[model samples]
Target: MKPSIPPPPTQEDEALIKDYLLHRMLQTVLERDIQIFKTLELTMTNLYILNLQHIIKRMSDPYWTVKHQIRQRGIRIESKSWTPEGEIQVLYLCRGYQRSLLCSWPPMKEELKDRIISYLGTDLAAY
Candidate 1:
């Protein structure tokens, strides 16, 4: 009798494992960053927690209401489904004051760019 060998993992299994690892790494990094941000007193940047609706529904918290922020005023949050490449539930730490300033003067492109850079510490094309 010949000995049989186990077949290699399927593509779906590999994809699922990849996603799980990515999410775990993202969570760890986000947690660390949150601690650092808190310790450094980075009040200018605010952490926006997205995907709260799913959590609320799962927990059956009917009283919980999520106040949606206007993305035009700050860095837009990316959807995990669309942004599978290292995308997570936590949004960037945006500067509230900068967002407000930008909203105050939407027509001024240069002013908006400068404000974003000042707050985010980098010039992002997304802004």
Candidate 2:
């Protein structure tokens, strides 16, 4: 006995298949776009929280003031922070610039500390 072949698809069947495939493709694209949008929203939120431009400006004054000291001691900016305690702390490294410095500038007034930390979207503990 010979094997039987299936009947060819009708035009209506072909149209239905095309429609189903197009629908699936559109759904896939929509899902991908939604994920991308979510990621963008998260990144924007973080950026808003950071407010990086203002943070940079806040650090600039102290950096300029200590630049001469830095040159003399070969100390470099290891880490820096405008702490929630209202202190401008910069970990300056010296001795071939590999050691953490224990020095910190005097704390700003308590009110200022509170304001800065609030704007930074974090508390002292978070910092």
Candidate 3:
């Protein structure tokens, strides 16, 4: 008997897989950041801001086309409340949006920690 080949994935299947991978990647990034924050005494709000800045700086185009597109999709780029917890909440809300962009169009190869330091404009070696 000959072995049978599996059928190719449909568009729906592909979409589901893509969504799963995107969420998994976002979760992994968040977990790693939380662990680093624990050691560096960073708050959830700081993590949220760092991630937000990275997304804006890295994802936006000169014409603001990408930014506008994401905004149209109801992604929260700014925090509405003036509290750390609120910022953290916004961060969680932005996770799917960030991951969607990151998944469909990956940015340059840079670690989250390095990006955070760069965003802070601080020289770690000096510390």
RMSD of every candidate to native, in Å, equals: 19.0, 30.7, 14.7
lDDT of 3 by residue, 37-89 (tens): 65674456676656654644543342255334434444443331224322211
Can you give the TM-score per candidate against the true fold? 0.32, 0.28, 0.31
Clashing pairs in 2: none
Ranking by lDDT: 2, 3, 1
Candidate 3 ranges with C-alpha deviation above 4 Å: 1-8, 42-127
TM-score of 3: 0.31
By lDDT, the best candidate is: 2
**What does candidate 1's lDDT look like per residue over 1-127, in tens digits?**
9976434334433333333333333345445555565566444534422222232233232122111222222333223232344332332223222111111123233443453344345557667
- At residue 119, what lDDT does model 3 achieve? 46
Off by over 4 Å in 1: 1-8, 45-125
**Preferred candidate (lDDT higher): 1 or 3:** 3
Of candidate 3, the 10-residue stretch with the lowest lDDT total is 86-95
lDDT of each: 0.34, 0.44, 0.42
lDDT for 31 (candidate 3): 61
How many backbone collisions does model 3 have?
A: 0
- Greater TM-score among 1 and 2 belongs to 1
